[model samples]
Target: MLRSFSYLTDHTGFCGTIKNSPSDFVVTEIEVTEHSLRDTQAKSLQKPMEVLLGQSSPGLCAQSCDGGGTPVPADQGLRWAGDSCPASPCQNQHESKAELKPGLEDASVLDSLLGKAVSELLNKYACDLKDVWKSKSDANAGTREFSLGPILDKKNRADLHSAIRQKFPFLVTVTKDNEMIVKGNADYRELCQFVTEKETSDFFKFLDAKLENSTFSFEPDGDKEHRKVVHHFINRKFGKLLETKSFTVTDVNDQQNMSIMVRFREKGWSRKRPAGGFQEKQDLYTAFTLQKENLETLEAISFLAAELGVLPSDFSYTGIKDKKAITYQPMVVKKVTPERLKEIGNKMEKKGIRIHNIHSACQHLRLGQLKGNHFDVVVRDLKHHSHDSSADLKKRISEAMENVETKGFVNYYGPQRFGQGQNVQTDQIGLALLNEEMVKAVKLFFTPEDTDDPVNNAKRYFLQTEDAKGALVMLPEFKVRERMLLRALNRYGVNHEGCTKGWLSIPHSMRIFYVHAYCSKIWNEAASYRLSIYGSKVVEGDLVFSEETDETISLNDKVHVVTAAEESAKKYSINQVVLPMVGHSIKYPGNKVGQWYHERLSKDELQTCKFRVSPLQLNIPGCYRPILKNVQNLSYFLEGSEKGIEIEDNYLNESKVSLHISFDLDPSCYATVCLREIMKCDF
Candidate 1:
């Protein structure tokens, strides 16, 4: 799937050892709460001490208010509503529960509850985080926040909690009835005690003591089903043990869960690939128990970015990861010292986080965040309906590709999606498009259009009679014009308008020439696509390379028809030499002349062709050029001129292909356009 090349200059490779290997640094202080879980059960009398003052307790911090026995002014009440009091406040103390006002049940409250639940639900979490701080003599481990979404709807919160308890009772406590009371013996004191328990305290204290070693570790139960137990410990301990630090731990396999049976191989650690993988592995850095999230990947990057001293720009990822799918992505950070990396890892472990391993990477790793992610997705629950079959799905995909262009679907580098954890603006995409277009336009002029204008001393040639009569002028093929264009490109810089703005001779070199030619090709291709879409005939239309010469007679007077082969030849001749001929080739006097002769004689050579700038050109600069094959486009069209075949057809016909793929990913990433190469699909 990935390859590397070693060249003479150095041990080189293409898509080499994935740069920016995913860095698993321990972050402290970054805590994320699962938004939805089962309703919490109140701490029983015996569990009271453990519930309060415990790292994994229902983090209920209370503030006493003058419990005015009489209904205080509604304005002075704690903003909760209930059945006993119409549109009332003071936390709705009816004997049942506090019902939030219609839109007043803030997301933050749910978030808080979820955070509290995350601690209470997982015993290891409670032990590592709670005990650390309760036992102040022990140093704190770091903290890390993780994210879980689709916060439970208030109605479902209870059921979800129950399910959670059934699955992970040690992690959470489920209640059968509401226990919030604002009056009498059932007041704030009970609530306060319910949250700060000795169990939670001891948990945090344990992590704190563990942190003294500074090395982190994940001791997952190799059994896949029990992985969640490991992650539970990691998250809770990290949150409670470390006074200030954040970390993220992710599994490196499908189910991209946060759980792991990861144990530090202190004795077996070596700089060689692990049993199943092929990387220069290293010693397991830290160790601790872990639990899985039963979802997609763990977004360690976001957590690290927010908690550690990592800048948004400091990270690049390969895939637009799935938050629910347990997946691991290569990570990298620049401008940071090893000490810093170690410090971060240590801080994380001190709080109950375990760093499975840490080894130096030669290059930075990115999660394919650029150019968007590549995906192969498979859909389930597909019905074989006579009306809605796989064929229909394929048809829908094909149809969508032809009709509309999605706006928000930007042509930006993938990292743009996480714009500093902000939103991407239309203006940025627009600028990127514009810049690409201009670059392409420049390249186009360098190759095909460069020779349009004559060298003042050169004999300006023309095919005299231009009266639109079936007149064909195959004078010297398309290469002559292409050379001229290449020459012109060498001499002048082409602007967006396709006009020369400045001049440069072969004195400089080919790099500039390449840049110029590449840009122009992009611009022309964009234009050509637009023209084809608008019902224009580029197939047989007047393909002109010009400083318009007055034809002895106007061609408009008659219709001109030319062979497709001639058109192909001309297009090839003009663009072929633009990119490859410059600098040293320029130094050779007859190099251009030789190229001109070679292209004119070779009727079989295929070349890329395009017109001036178009919108799409703004994204991918460069016109279609002569190449062995355009694999990306071949699935739909007859690839190159496979022998000299001629067709008198008036229009290009549509051809379709069937495509099916399956994808497994972390959340927050989509497969909208990943299948473009196979079949264009957009909605």
Candidate 2:
């Protein structure tokens, strides 16, 4: 109900903070290692982690802080040892001791050597560091429990304190101890708005108990429900959790690179060839990483198949990686000979498609079968700079990273998920389709934006005049979807009844995307609203998913009361809050959340039951999304980088940084959403 941060102090340790710009935020993917069935389940059951592959620069892993505040130059710090240290899964540690020299001990003499400006800078920010330290201590030692909450699974745990700069910039503390969050089973107590101080005094008293694995449980610290009646508040904020920071990301497609390796998912793939290479059996699989320059997977495969005299179907990929960015993903060729594949790979590389690790396997790949994607990204050319000093930049970055790392960032869908032109507008037209607004859907499809393409501009005149047939005539031959809609309208009239039929004429996949997008919009909106109202708290009548493979709970498994559920949910990370994805056969959550869903639909004049139109078989049963996203192996570092560009603008500058970041997310999680919280800017 309230956040009280008065308890933290410099006397106790904390994770320090630093800031980063999108100068060179490099994200490299860490492909999950293949495992046996037992290993797979064991890994799945392990607690989730928010650790990412983190290093401030391409090189330069900093050493852990020993609590006393002071700057350790790159030459002296263990983190900067780079190759000598285990940067990957860095143990932010004081593994090495500083051999203090004379004169440096005197702050003034050292300041003079570093320059008066640098000296003044340290004086300006030293107190700020203490405050940051105190705030962390408070968050760690008081109101908020010290547990990492699936965030501490990072291998860098013990040494994070040493790596965090305790002086200016990175002021966050790094402590090795953890406090258990208040769970239902803790010295747990519920405090409602109606309670009097006397009735709730006992609950507040437990705040002083030994917090670490105390194994202490007690009764509701209240003696009675006070006479005053208060309403139970539910989270109802309406927006994504991403902050609003602005930085430019260039060199995006500069080197759209991707290197992928695949493990065959089929069994009995050991067939060998007479020439020492594995013999290509019909069921044999060949796993490889397809690295192509400026070519989509399909395009790359198509070109290769043409040259090799094989159908593209000979190559089966688990999923498609981004065509624009340098991506790496595993792929397999079913029943393919290694020799022939090698020949194709050789020819393919000459054509800009470089295939790596084309080896035979016993199994084939299934969609979403691999562990997770690894990202190596570089955020470049930050336009805005409040200050040019490295100290200032690091300080800002430290603060942001500390906040994001600790509290976690908001999870939201980025703009790329939405299609161009009226196809998908945060699921607007899709919602219209679900609502059965035939005329609305058709009109929206024809609605041209200000930056209309030439094709769209050509059709705009006819569409604006309500001449559907004329618009169809203006559509180019390549406008397959558009022509289909026009043909339907030409046959049927131009009314809602006619347009509904026209809407049905579009490809089923395309139409379903629209519907799904709309559903996503609903989810985003609902999630935002709930976070605002409840601030990530559990409430009465919520439904929590039991497993990744399990679908949403049926109506029969609903929670009808609040009682101790809040404490239980908070303890187990089972907030039970979920939103419907706007589909038929989808049973929405119960109580306030469900009511809120209905309210949202009523405002949009839509309903889940309305997703039953057969025109395009858009009748998809919906899914549910948890309000929070689990992040694994979160780590980051920022350093001064030379890869920058200057622009003549109000905020554009030439300063650049290579903020190295690495993490693994579930298959459906959006990396953009996570980065948004850090950059707080448009990608």
Candidate 3:
């Protein structure tokens, strides 16, 4: 069955073709980082500074003296000066001078100067600083600066600088207005000095040692534009290892003005602790950027796993990339060394896969961990109306692109969400599973289609002859899921229990993918119905996220139905409207659209409350998705047929033109759906 999707733009979209060649489509993943995850962790770690310092009472500072110093009220602004307290009147002044004595190496001095909270946080990484100073023979040992997270008080900042200079003579302090930077002085090497555009390889060599937790600083020789290129190059090469931060530094030749300085250090290096002290557990997963041409994400990972003698389940990634396109995504594997993966990757160059930027990751890659995907798509063989000239066609295409950018597009799951081929619809198997018809689902899996592929032929042979062994012979080796199911059926016989076993033999991800595809189909139909009935207006029955809804909240808990008063007041915009993916726990719209969901579910002989299957352990509590998605950084350019033809012996006619469109979509949004809006044709 063909699924119809609605478009947000009203422009008459022209016909254009995509995926003429694998190179015509390129997808690059935008990754999530530790800095982004910190916001999610902030709410859980909400203890006050005094609590971290182990203070018995609130507003009491931890003392620096051997025996606990006399408790002074926090309002007095008086602190302990070790043993040299002359009197209460001059106690504060005496404490400051005594604490600033040269060669004073007490860690408590840091607590007194920067407050108990900041001192404890710094102490957690004190091992990193101590290691640098201890390693005098190390070439990479150098001055390392740590940011004291924004201090707005002028006196507090000045106190921090003075404390570092006097108490710790080996350390130097500088202030960028209100922010204090504490730098540890040690022997350093100029790894790459005055690096020009042509000498990027030297910079890469320096980055190669970054994995060993080395720290170094270099100033690239360039203007702003050239430096920008160098920055991009560094990110592309050493993104996983480099903990990059931009700061202003006085120019080496000209001290009057400041220049942009980028600091590079190994990720998570600062958090290391001294030997036998409390330390973070080493990461079990190794993540790397997997770049491939004409290979599915799983297929590439499976190939690598097979080469490395590991299970395919050992690898994880944020999302699947297109099989027929050049794609780059981050993938992680548990207990695998970067060296082993790199060795296998070097051999995979001939197989259209290249892996790089390998590093240790604290956790496995999870779905929806990426910001989004950036697509560079080339649409060829553009057809024009008979009345339109080349210029007119280009003008219309330009207008369509602008309309898509301004009005957005329907956020429908693309056809690829459903498995390829017309012989068996993946959603049918999903529906059978939900209904507890395991035998029926298994039969559907083996259902013969019109396609003449070898896999289908094997399925037909197996169904007609009941010969699992024979079918296995004809099936390709790469069809792991099919082989596993057949093997299970062969051992258990094709009965109810056997079919259940066969279905369970498939990977959990693949099984869940089928059910999600069914939910996506329902969502696509409901979204089209909504646009047809209610145009672009925010209706009273529509659903929008509540004011309390945010990234930290669970998806199922974020739904809020639009009320009549709110709709009248125009509180929610059309873009804010969302549709449920249809589940037992999901709440439908309050109007005809909600009723439409019931009718649609009734047609399938299913109920919203029946999404859970206890025997199969499949509990799909569906989530809400936005009905519309906006395009970011959308731009397009027209190319003549002869200019952009990737395949030399082109099949397209001389009149054919290519439209190169580039844009970014948020996570879980499909680029093909956006292309459907631009072309007004099913992909």
The candidate maximizing lDDT is 3
- Candidate 1 lDDT trough over 10 residues, lowest sum: 57-66
Please report how far candidate 2 places residue 409 from its true position, in Å.
2.9
lDDT by residue for model 2 (574-608), tens: 33445556555456666666788898888887644
Candidate 3's clash total is 0
Give the per-residue lDDT digits (tens) of candidate 1, residues 1-683: 00021001111101101111112111111111112111111111001111111111011100011111233233322211111231212221221111122332343443354576653533344345435434556343313222233443544443333333222212332221122111111111122232333332333223222211122223223454444433444434332222211123334553322312111111111223334432222211111112112221123433343455554345433333432222323344544544555566655543323333344432333211222222333222222224332333434433433322221111111221222222332223223233344434333222222244342112122112211111112222222323333444334434433322211222112113233333333322323332333222223333222111111112211112223664566542221111111111111112233243235323222122221124332112221111110111111211112323332332222222112333321222233322221232111
lDDT of each: 0.27, 0.45, 0.64
Highest TM-score model number:
3
Between candidates 1 and 2, the lDDT winner: 2
lDDT of 1 at 13: 9
For candidate 3, lDDT tens digit of each residue in 359-399?
86654665325778999999877776454455456556767
Sorting all predicted structures by TM-score, with the top scorer first, yields 3, 2, 1
Which parts of model 1 are misplaced by more than 4 Å? 1-302, 316-328, 335-357, 362-376, 380-566, 569-671, 674-681
Q: What's each prediction's TM-score? A: 0.22, 0.48, 0.62
Give residue 501's error in model 2 in angstroms.
5.9
Which has the better TM-score: candidate 2, or candidate 3?
Answer: 3
| Cα displacement (Å) at residue 248, model 3 | 51
Instruction: At residue 181, give the lDDT of candidate 1.
Output: 10
Off by over 4 Å in 2: 1-324, 329-370, 383-391, 420-426, 449-455, 458-507, 547-577, 586-591, 639-654, 681-683
